[model samples]
Target: RLAGSAAGWGFQFQSPGFVVAVCWLLFLMGLNLLGVFEVSAGRLGQVQTGSGRGGDMMTGLLAVIVATPCTAPFMGVAIAGALGGSPVMGVLVFLSMGLGLAFPYILVAGVPGVASRMPKPGAWMGILKQVLAFPLFATCVWLLWVAAIQRGVTFVALTAGGVVLLGFAGWIYGVGQRRSMLEGGRGTVAFCRVVAALCVVICGAALAQGLRAAPAPVVAGAVEAGVEPFSEARLAELRAQGKPVFIDMTASWCITCMVNERVALDVPSVQEAFRSRGIVFLKGDWTNRNAAIAEFLKAHGRDGVPFYMYYAPHQDGVVLPQILTPGIVISTIGK
Candidate 1:
């Protein structure tokens, strides 16, 4: 769940078209954390809710989803190598990630010893579950900070407010759940539950309004000072003309991207290399979701930003290491 939350808040939403989805998801998680629907659904699904052969097929389906947002260390190198190979290899590379996510559940189903040793659910389980919720909460806070940096205070305030509303709704729902559990009057429990549901609905609507009404982000136009903006059409045009192009796929919320830019890509020595090598330094500002850039990243087995690639004159591009130094950029251009 921490992975899911971080994936949504940091990696995925750096692009456009993902904010609403994250907001909705965070809201849903809020409900879950508050114990809103647990009362209705009874216990959570089995460790093997979808573990049989047929259900296991969904592993491949979930592969790309899990892979698409985690810019983990060594992940880029492995993915780039796979993408540089055959299509089958690339699919396998992606499927591996989904399989990892489903591994825990699969293990319980496949290994009797593991399942037999598992502690039965009881009051103690609730304590552990609540402890897990803290990590999710921390992830949300981290995401809030990231959102502020990328989308600004207005967006952060709106989003933070929405999160608050979801929490309030969850608390109300939890109150209702406790009442019912305590065998309180059915009418009172029903009233509290209905009220809680209403709160959640209002939160959804409020969030939608905030998302739609939010102002467009302002680009700092840093490239006019030196760098060139990167686009699919522009990149193809340059490459077809036998130009040397270095593409930087970056986002505002990406710490790695920022450090790379400051210490390597944008340094004075690297800028000189660009001039000497006649390299066209094109920047893909993945600070917001651009479908073109997203597709380009995926084509190379990348699920998130901070992608660095070099296209030599009339040649297939090469994926550069995600971690960069000035020497690295200069050396690549000299090639």
Candidate 2:
């Protein structure tokens, strides 16, 4: 929050490289869960450390970083408050949030006999572990979709190729592990692992180059009919004309934004209401890091996407809830 505030709160969003890196991590994690490879006490899936304390600390840090994006929309209010207030207040809010996040784990750890109550090891456990890989795979697909929206098809192709290479590396590494277990051909096992590591490095380097390439042009008027691309000047013009306007500040990577649009904004009833009521729907795409959109979010005391504002004719804009229902939209416009 402090870093974001220092940069005018626009840098709160992740970069294209960060998204691609996370997608790769999720892909590799899925492969690990699917029995493609084992890290053998390495810091990937089912991570192991010689010292339990270091492992626990690293795992906690990793959890916080990964979970932040998923929880940002819901935590916007508190985050905004933290950013807008004093440094002490900001620290308190974050400290409170961390405590809240750790509470469930603390509860589980503190309780006696919790592990004893868990079902004994069985075939079902293996099946469940494999089944869990699908969600990781799905999340990787979603991130790639977000990448497509941000950079274009070429970016996705590059990322997809990287994913394939990662899979190949995993397979090769797994083969080496199996051979080494039989206690023969140690030299061949070492050679296989070296080759697998090289493949991973090559994939990472290629992806880095792809991300550094220029993004595709943002085509105007490509959105759904009746929705206009948002611009500050356009907003001012509409407001000057005493027209009602709804500003949707969203990003492709924002899960809550997608959910709200699907459940409320994209519905027939809401579309009809928008047409009949003559509301100007202006959408700001923050899929890529945009300074203008960042400024707009900052003006509204927000540091993240999924921000919604409604401007009634001749009135100040009214901020809406993070979660929206069709009824909420219809009623907000009807008034």
Candidate 3:
């Protein structure tokens, strides 16, 4: 179910953060397996005598993350069918993929002896816990790299250093009997956690806003084009212009759509064609959830973004291919 949500929400394995997150999680699991760290499961710690089923679940989740990019043989067809089908069908396709990935673990967990054969809890778990810290450290590095790509190197470096320092401070507090650190007890820890969470929220919001505010890239030899969110009245007006209307139904989360916009759509030749031919460029932003856009998608038999449609003057809309090329856009507009 989570896998489906992730995929639907444009969180693909190809995404840098997704890759880093999976690797970091796996590293943490391996550490647990080696008995370096012990995660408490409330009062049930005694009954749960194994490397840690929670860690295993984490492993399973990582497995899904890694597998998402490889689009299985029939997966592409399934996704296409689902997108063009009903909303229920779209959801079912995502659910099916999740179940397929989770099947192995589900089968193993269901077996009687499989769970019992797991290693019993032991003292060596502490060693495993320490070793697992390295993976967490590695994950921090990966996240920094992703942040650098999306935002900038300086922001990522500072954030990474801050996290490392915080982790070190926490470790020191755990090890030492310093009066200032120990006296506050749960209150201090809880307060610190809240502060950290708030910092994260602020940083994320700032980053998103910064990215949004950044200037759109310029494509030379092409007239400056603007795309507004879709509206029925606007479509009718464009149709009245007696020119081809290239309707781009996209969301902020759609990587393929972004790629096309950055490459094909922004290319000089593509832009020139649109300009000379008087092609009306229409963009439907579906970044946030919108019932109007949802209805628009349903009416057109599509369930997701990167849904390209070419409307010939006074004719029905023609759905364009998902994977776009400059020639495709030009040719469609010329027709």
Candidate 4:
């Protein structure tokens, strides 16, 4: 669905993005931990709870949102193609994608024997729910690392502090809920509400402060050594002059981008090719949002960072594969 609306669909994929997604997932998990889901589902969280279809839909939605959809193999091409076409086509494509993803759940729902064979609800379900939260927390840690790279140490510390504050608030809310449940006092519930409010306020203020302090300009030089900042104007000028150019749209957070840089693009032969052929290496850092690169990606049937294209003299841009080889670069651009 995101790709279907790709023209104006822009996401920074930054710390704030990570925090919002993670926070929501944590909130849902908190509810699950506190037995909100179980109670609502009549203790088993089973399909017979009257929201079977809704639960399946939510699962599909969460899969799309929590996981970066474009990173999957062939997903970029499918979404990119969908986005480039008419709106109706795009929507159909997205719907098809959703249906394909949800097929497994549909199968289980349709087959009673399959559902019956599933693990019985027991005390272990609670343990499994808690264990699942760890991956989300680990994701928070990864986002903080990327944030440090984009901003600085202070920014990272502030973001970390915000996480700590959120955890403290959750703890307070948990305690408050416990007291309210056991004692059934209006005072306890009121105190819990107050703490939740404070948590929201403190977290917002901390994030705002971090943003204000982070004036670090997104620089191409910061992307990698000897790579020029990408601009459409510069690229056009070079292409008009019949000069060869290589474009790298990447983000620090993209592991594929880093791996490609280290293994293929930054190798001696690849670097030497640029020096010999005068391949103007321009990098668009999508660590932060840039509308130009976003559009460019869409134009080339690509939806995200780590997209590579080579514009040869007197020729249109040749879109390179996501995974680059030293020989691929040397032969394609070196010649």
Candidate 5:
């Protein structure tokens, strides 16, 4: 809501604090899924009473948190269009997308026969829940990789320690819940809760200390055969010389961007085509926030990374599809 309004609060992708926060959130969620501890509403005790609404709300929240960083090929156009238009349009577009995502579950739930055919609760469900935890764990690993790229090794080390603390907190909390159920002792439960809270606090303190320290210097990577760092001045210089240029705006955290690079941009044939065609490749690293790159994306009617633009000499820049194949790149450059 804030993003669409005049407030225009743009998100900084790969921010150290944001990345660590998400990492911890996912790590804790994975622990929950693994049965370390169940989340409680405390005040809204109804949630724990199996009304089903709480689970639905949690599913929706998890989906939004994990999916926000992604700009899928199919939805890229719709998202860009929404962001470029009035706030009303943005809200409507997002709501429509949400409906699209939820439609499958809604259908199954609404259809009596479909619901009847679903399997009844059993021990298999417990096994399945534990299985699902792995994916969340994998996602945490990926986020840590993003943190390493942006903030370097020190950040990752501190974040890893925080993960340990979180796991310990979850464990202690689970022990408290079990004891409270078995022995029904209030004092014991209160002591366990206090210890768990302290662990979490210490974890937060460690993360804060890590963030206060300056990040390790980013070592310059070896330049690829035909690629150069992207900048507005360089783009203009190439255009003035009437040279064809291909701009790759990407980020380390963008899975689609990474896939496209491996499958399309880095393919031998694509590299050969660039060499033969005398095309200049400018690679923009949006792994960390860059205002210039953000402005370029906005100018091109996009609000996220994985943006690709091809500028032919004497012609306007052409935006390529979000999902690319080697054939797509070769053919685009061939033109």
Candidate 6:
């Protein structure tokens, strides 16, 4: 869906942090398979339990989200083509990508013989569970890196610490579970469920708040002090004045876009080149998913962002590459 929208609507594809998160997840899963960590059968052992179901569902969701950051080589061309086509066409392309991702999991889970051949619940399971925690730890590290890019190291540390504490609490709870607790009365089980739900809700809220409080990243070398974002009307007016305009359409969730701005766009030479060429720089914020921006993307055949469009005086508009380079920008403007 994202790739299709990006191509059709000219949105940029920026997802390095996502890529790291996915790689870490795969690494952790691999470690579990290799018997690096053990899974435990405890009071919360029943796969049918609400908590177990919730955990499994959450894991599945995280897998999907993490996988989205890195486009496999085979998927790149299809995604690019979707972004440059009609909305329906773009959506179809995304659907194909989704199917490709889900197929392996479905096959593994559906085949009864294959599922039975998998390691039975045992001591190794406990070790596998502990090893799985390492991936979550790695994920925290990656999130911290991304947070450091936007906010400071302090905020990153705080967020990472909080996430670690949450994990530690979960580990303690899991390890403390006794067989007696599993055989306890219905009332006792109900109470435990309530407590677990409350804890999960609290942890979720804290994480959301931490992410919200993180500061916006500053585009390096750009004098952002009082430069207001450009409206569509303002862009049209500038075009009327025969000035070249560079539009950066981005969102807070876009890690790749942020990196591009800080590392490439913010370079002194890039900034100077834009200024010297009398280029009007405009930033279109898509943090909250504005309807106008959505329409803008749909017009270009996109459904999501990190989109970049360049309009030059007396020339055809140019769609910038998804992966940015200083030379790409300089050359585009120079033309």
Residue-wise lDDT of candidate 5 within 112-204, one digit each (tens)?
Answer: 998888999999999998898899899889988888887788788889989998899999898898999999988989988999899988988
Better of 1 and 3 by TM-score: 1
Q: List TM-score per model, in order.
A: 0.62, 0.90, 0.51, 0.74, 0.90, 0.58
- Model 5 ranges off by over 4 Å: 1-12, 40-55, 219-225
Q: Write the per-residue lDDT of candidate 3 for residues 130-209, one digit (tens) a residue.
A: 67667666654554544454435544544554454434434443333233355746655565556545654554454445
**Who wins the lDDT comparison?**
5
Query: How well does model 6 score by local distance difference test?
Result: 0.59
- Candidate 6 worst ten-residue window by lDDT: 6-15
Give the lDDT of residue 66 in candidate 4. Answer: 54
What is the TM-score of candidate 2?
0.90
lDDT tens readout by residue for model 2, 95-205: 999889888777767786775676789999989988999999998898888777777888889989989888888899888888888877899799989989999899889
Give per-residue lDDT, candidate 1, residue 135: 61
Question: Once superposed on the true structure, which residue ranges of model 4 sit more than 4 Å away at CA?
Answer: 1-59, 69-73, 113-127, 149-154, 180-186, 205-214, 217-221, 236-244, 253-255, 266-278, 323-331
> Between the candidate structures 2 and 4, which one is better when assessed by lDDT?
2
Q: Show the colliding residue pairs in model 4.
A: none
Error of 1 at 283 (Å): 2.2
Which stretch of 10 consecutive residues in model 1 shows the poorest summed lDDT?
1-10
Better of 5 and 6 by TM-score: 5
Name the TM-score of candidate 3: 0.51
